[model samples]
Target: MTEDLTGKRALVTGAASGIGAATARWLAAHGVTALVLVDLDGPGLAALDMPCEVLPFPGDVTDEALWDRIEAEAGPLDYAVINAGIAGGAPIATMTLDEWRATLSVNLDGAFLALRCATRLVRDHGAMVLTASVSGLKAEPGTAAYGASKAGLMQLGRVAAKELAPRGVRVNCIAPGGVDTPIWDQTPFFQEMIAQAGGDRAAAMAALSGAATPLARFATADQIAAQIGFLLSDAAGTITGTSLVSDGGYLL
Candidate 1:
């Protein structure tokens, strides 16, 4: 069932593409009045066409100044989807300090800033969803930084939920496995992985899915967006501090 969000406002981070963009569209489809979309992609943010009013903020999510601007400009938010992240892959022994910092800066610090701002600005009874990763729940060799950051994000959501409960704000986490998104194309590690499958991204994805994910396929961006939508809606009013795994049984 599509929830009616006619008068509500939402803020979505990493809004230029992938799951973030998909979630913005989903909120608009459900009748959200306005959206505050944040991302580092200027052209991508400017190009987005949505049904609701969009206030695009193009900047680094880790910047406290950006959050200050967002809070000032966005007014009262009814929902927040803290979904901005970057993937980093390397064995801990070989991973540079810079690489590890870069991953955690976005995946963890960014989430913390976004959630802190959201908890402050969201109206009472508001809700939020954080994009975590299956990597956090179950680790593999090359996921040192990414896995640690996501695991931290999951725990952050739980703590945020507890602290915000008194104010009627609910916070939840979504730990997605492999989703067919442009992120794969952008990450160097994934590019190499894709190359190993003879430059066929789909084939590589399928091979990985077959080997790891019980469902044998990648989750679509829209699929994850739908789950975010549900968590933000009234139907999930009682849910908080829960990490909803949408990984096609990858962890299983």
Candidate 2:
């Protein structure tokens, strides 16, 4: 049975696109009445046409003032998806201090801010899902900054879960391997790969996913969104402080 979220309200970071946007649409389709969508992409936020009430907040997640404004204005929420993040990668030796700090600022510190605000605004029995990445769990040469940040987020989710348990709130992480998301477009490596494939992004994605993933394909944003929805639902009431890795067997 599909869990109904009628009259529910939610906060979705990174909601302008990819998994965040998909989750927002999924929640609306499942009967959520309202959503407060946060993202750095103002145009992207404005472009979304969800069935429910959508309050789009455009700003950087790393900005504490932005989150503070949200807490003051968005009011109560039943669910929170702390999914705003960026893609950054470089070998430890070559990666600049600026690069390292940038990744941590958005993926880890930004999550902290969002979680803090959500804990204040979200009701007891509410749930939160952080969008961590498989890079955090399994190390790669160039992924130090990205991996460390996501690793921190995973730990943050666990700690938050423990701390919020007494209040009947649950926290979890979704560590996706490589679902096709616009976040990839931000990386120069992927852009070069696309160029190699004669600008066919799908071909580039297929080549990469086919090589690394046992499933031979990357997941779609909608697929990941469904998982997030399940995690936020009553069906996942007993699950907390854990990560649901949706990597298409890439870890293997």
Best by TM-score: 2
Predicted candidate 2 versus true structure: per-residue lDDT over 1-252, tens digit per residue: 388899899999999999999999999999999999999999999999988899889999999999999999998999999999999888899999999999999999999999999999999899999999999999888999999999999999999999999989999999999999999998989999999999999999999899979999889999999999989999999999999999999898
Spell out the clash pairs found in candidate 1: none
Identify the runs in model 2 with alpha carbons over 4 angstroms from their true place. Answer: none
| TM-score (C-alpha, index-matched) for candidate 2 | 0.98
What TM-score does candidate 1 reach? 0.97
For each of the candidates, the C-alpha root-mean-square deviation to the true structure, in angstroms, is 1.1, 0.8
Please give the distance, in angstroms, between residue 126's alpha carbon in candidate 2 and its true position after superposition: 0.7
Which tens-of-lDDT digit does each residue in 86-187 have in candidate 1? 987888999999999999999999999998888889999999999999899997988999999999999999999999999899999998998989887867
Off by over 4 Å in 1: none
Q: How accurate is candidate 2 locally (lDDT)?
A: 0.94
Every candidate's lDDT: 0.92, 0.94
TM-score, each model? 0.97, 0.98
Q: Which candidate has the highest lDDT of all? A: 2
Question: How many clashes in each candidate?
Answer: 0, 0
Per-residue lDDT value at 175 in model 2: 94
